[model samples]
Target: MHGLLSAYSPLSKVIRKKGIPYLCSPMPPSTRTPYTGSSRKLVLAFDVGTTYSGISYSILDPGQVPEIKGVTRFPAQEKVGGSSKIPTVIYYDKAGKVRAVGAEALRESLRDTIEDEGWVKAEWFKLHMRPKAITSSNPMDKIPPLPAGKSVVDLFGDFIRYLYSCAKLYITESHANGTQLWSSVERTIDFVLTHPNGWEGGQQQQMRKAAIQAGLVPDTIEGHARIRFVTEGEASLHFCIQSGLTTEALKSGGGVMIVDAGGGTIDLSAYGEGPTKGTFEEIASPQCHLQGSVYVTIRARTFLENYLRESKFVEDVEAMTEYFDKSAKLTFDSNPLFIKFGGARDRDPKLRIRGGQLTLSGTEVAAFFEPSVSCIIRAIKMQCMAAKKPISSLFLVGGFSASEYLFSKLKEELAPLGPNVCRPDSHLNKAVADGAVSFYLDHVVAMRVSRFLYGTKCKVNYDRKRADHVLRFAGVFNDVDGIPCLAGSFDVILPKDVQVSETQEFRKHYIQKAFDRIGLEAATSLIYCYRGALEKPLWWNGSSDFSALCTIKADTSKISRCLKPRLTTWGQTYYEMFFDIVLSFGLTELTAQIAWLEDGVEKRSPAKIVYDVDA
Candidate 1:
């Protein structure tokens, strides 16, 4: 009879019938509609940068492509006698009004004409907000400062707001196809803000909050006016991908390294395909350090400062801040002082420096930046090694990516690695913003094609002695043929990564028992172990013993039933199950089944039988 009972047990019964479970979640809302012919308008894509920004507009006509207008440093209006490249400065007047920002602010400093009473300074201001301080091997110390009292956060907000204002003005003043067209329909402007991917979560959050505060969106914008964020390297990749470059060939899974040498930070990331077919992935997470164009610029400025001092050309560096600021704009010119002092070479031949009887060519200017460029290349090479993949190609982007000398140096350094090293077209700086927009569109569209699953169930089992020892309690069970059985073993359902969008379903499964009325006190627990090692438990420390079955709760009900799981998204793969458990009561023993899915089908099997008794 015992043999027969064992043969007919619930566990045996389940073993005889193997099956799996199928789960589903609610579908995402639709975002597409019939394309009725409407007046062709433009969608603005703005890339807001530390020292410069660019805007590109795409016409919505059925076959029209996006067009990039002028990319310039802020303060669109030319200074009375100043060079370009927004100075990254802001100042206030005696009347407490913002007197200047960008290039004008830099001019005031260079000329030593800035008023003391209402002035504020901000040089390399963006670098200050990052987790690490910007440093260089050169002797360029003492960055320009913002107002003494205003926080860096506030200054950033103000600067972004100023950019939006400038953008609005530019759109209004510019001609549409050279016809000086204007429109009554307020054009929807979408912003893409780029940041170093290595930023801490808190810093990313702060940037988002600041963007919202700066009116990037209208609490809610009409139509698709939105502000999105993308990492700088990823953005540059997008720019390269769109530039009719070799991106398509590279996408077949070959490893590629991206180096984003920007104004305030150098960001690096790797992408590659696995040995198997179609298993492309971002090989290494992005890394960032506070070193970029500003480092070289500062070094060049220092060299010039010392050169001027020794030559008796300038008495005080501080007194000549405005002049230096203007001279910095000479970046577009050949033989600018920055180049003469060891900056990157200029491509423009017309920009020659006039000395008493000496003329400096681009080569002389390029010599100044050779050392700095070498430093940058070395950093890139180090980062490539850290990625651990044999790089098949190297892509450079950002403001400094355009430096011909820097590009040449990169080729030389990476030559042994292979010949695929290249720079994205001039528009690489806008890549991040463009990528953000593309990502958004892809995500929204993909949701329409795939359904997500949320909450599900799984079962747990343990030896009777082990269970009793772990729980410090006893329980009994009945044999399959109805004979009384000793308290020897136990089984329970443990929640894994169940993709419940909300907490309600999580609670219901844990609390809803067929025969038990365990109070909430019996449900709290310390550790909720899944299938593997219990190194990182979900609960807080000292809450309850591991033996005490804790109730697992999802934060929202929507996730429990409405969220469709996607294979590509991390949120779906991380969670396995979605229920909680508690101590049982009322019987000498209990035997039952816990339902869980195996493949696509649901199955129930004898999980465990717990004996009710005092340990």
Candidate 2:
């Protein structure tokens, strides 16, 4: 790995000397264009949380402010809890068919007593996709095997398909009626999926494939329903900032740590004000872990089942759980949660009933909440430690952020550290979904900090001055003329935490030796990447830190007719093909172009990132 200075310094001078054409041109100009979709354009913002999901949309040009409609138009409408979101639970039958989804699944479970009916109900399935989420710190950390004979991705595809269908139906029906919509009548519906900030390209690919299968995104050259992904932390930040929910953190350059505590994972990202107002830049690499509000529910459920199965008010455990979630979870009080049951105090003296209300011991309530509370605090501490300056505000928003107990505890612990804790009063329920619509409109984040070290695999010559002599024996090498050429080296092109802007580009040249470059066939380029801050990680075969981030290929059919193969002085014969790898990083996703810039007419080849499975 290069030193801190080398990681952040200008790369043109150093890389140019290595025969790599690093694009060091200054960032280009910018512009914003309003939606051009016909008389009315529909944008769908979908948030698939761990325990809940929400959908919201904006019209092309609906007055001065766009009306963000909730998902009350969908099935199980009454179970939406007066918002766009619904439970992320699904029920399946033994024949691998979906029995019910969302609130319907819960309703059916109690209506038929499915707990003993041999029916398979899956909940909190989102926890399985998070990388390294299962741990022993909490009792509910484990993700057991699925009983539905389907992968996590398969289940998620079904859910996403359902959401897309609802959005399509709404848009089609609204326009069918002679409605005077915002845009011209010749536009298409665009879809945006909001996910946790910690997800990598692998998860993104899984989601893309699923969306394609769901018919939301057409698999065609002129792709219909252009798809976009917005991270939950960034989306929540946009929601708060756009709604004027951020006050103290908006000051000049005060740092604000945004904690998105959803149902499954809690993600943290610190941001500082950009050059002007209403703009921001990432100040630290994001952090995430699977400690969410669902764990609290798990703790309470276990205690209830063990101690109160005989209570009359808790005859239906499903109803009892729902009551605890909707009525008691958000109410803030030092007193223990008490449910009103019939006057039966003499049946069990241990079940304390004050005025006929069964008292859930305060100790029980604290025990269920302490683990999640501690995890959230630790996550905030990590972001503060990573930030360049003290975090002046802790912006808390998400479904879990609605908890008064969680909010009060975080305020008490974080106030002393630096910033004031803020929980938006109105949008806490659907902030991620709503903010994603804002993200699609404004594209609030102009700059982002790369979380992983982006690089490639290459070889370097062994030298007595800097190269270790053990490399001669341990590392793979080829004898070039008498000197050893060390192979299997990690060449870092972009270091982690470096702020990458949209205008900047990085270009490198690659020449293959003796691989029959002129075969007039296919070509491939393997782009290696790692997550840690290791300066120069060796491309060891079995190291988990290093993996192929993406595989891109180039075309040589038009390899300049004048180009010739080179015969080395080392008595080795090889075919040399020279082409530059162009990288553009100005958008939300990293993209590359394998092309030749000749006479200002760029000739492009096939260069798509390849994904792999590894959890």
Best by TM-score: 2
Candidate 1, residues 1-615, lDDT tens digits: the string is: 000000000110011111211111121222223223355544444454556655544333433333334334345346453222344556765544566776556553444557546455555666556643223344553456666666666666777777666556666655564223325323444555667754433344455556667766555434223555556665555444334332343554456677887766777766554333322334554567655666556655565566565443344344333343334422433443432322233222333323221133456556546655666677667656655456677777777666555666676677886636666433545555554443332211100100011112322232345543345233334322232333322222323322112111222243221111221112222222233334334322232222222223322232233223323232222212333332211111111233433454654432332211110
User: How high is the lDDT of residue 419 in model 2?
Assistant: 74
Error of 2 at 78 (Å): 2.8
1-615: candidate 2 lDDT, tens digit per residue: 000000011111112312222222221121224444334557788898988898888766523334455555666656334456788877777777777777667663365656556668787787666654223366566554565578778778888877766665556565545233423432366778877877766677777777777667677645522778778888887766655544445554568778999887888888876654546778888777777887777777777777777765356445556667767766644467875544554245566755545577666787778888998898788888888767887778888887777877886787678676766545576888877877777665667777777778866667656645464546646543344667766666677777767667777776544435555244566676675556766654547677677776656667644355556576565565556677765456667777665556777765666666453
Q: Give the CA lDDT, 0 to 100, for residue 466 in model 1.
A: 57
Give the residue spans of candidate 1 off by over 4 A: 1-45, 59-76, 79-87, 94-96, 103-113, 116-118, 132-142, 175-189, 218-225, 248-253, 273-280, 301-375, 386-389, 424-615
In candidate 2, residue 311 scores what lDDT? 69
Candidate 1's TM-score? 0.55
Cα deviation of 542, candidate 2, in Å: 3.5
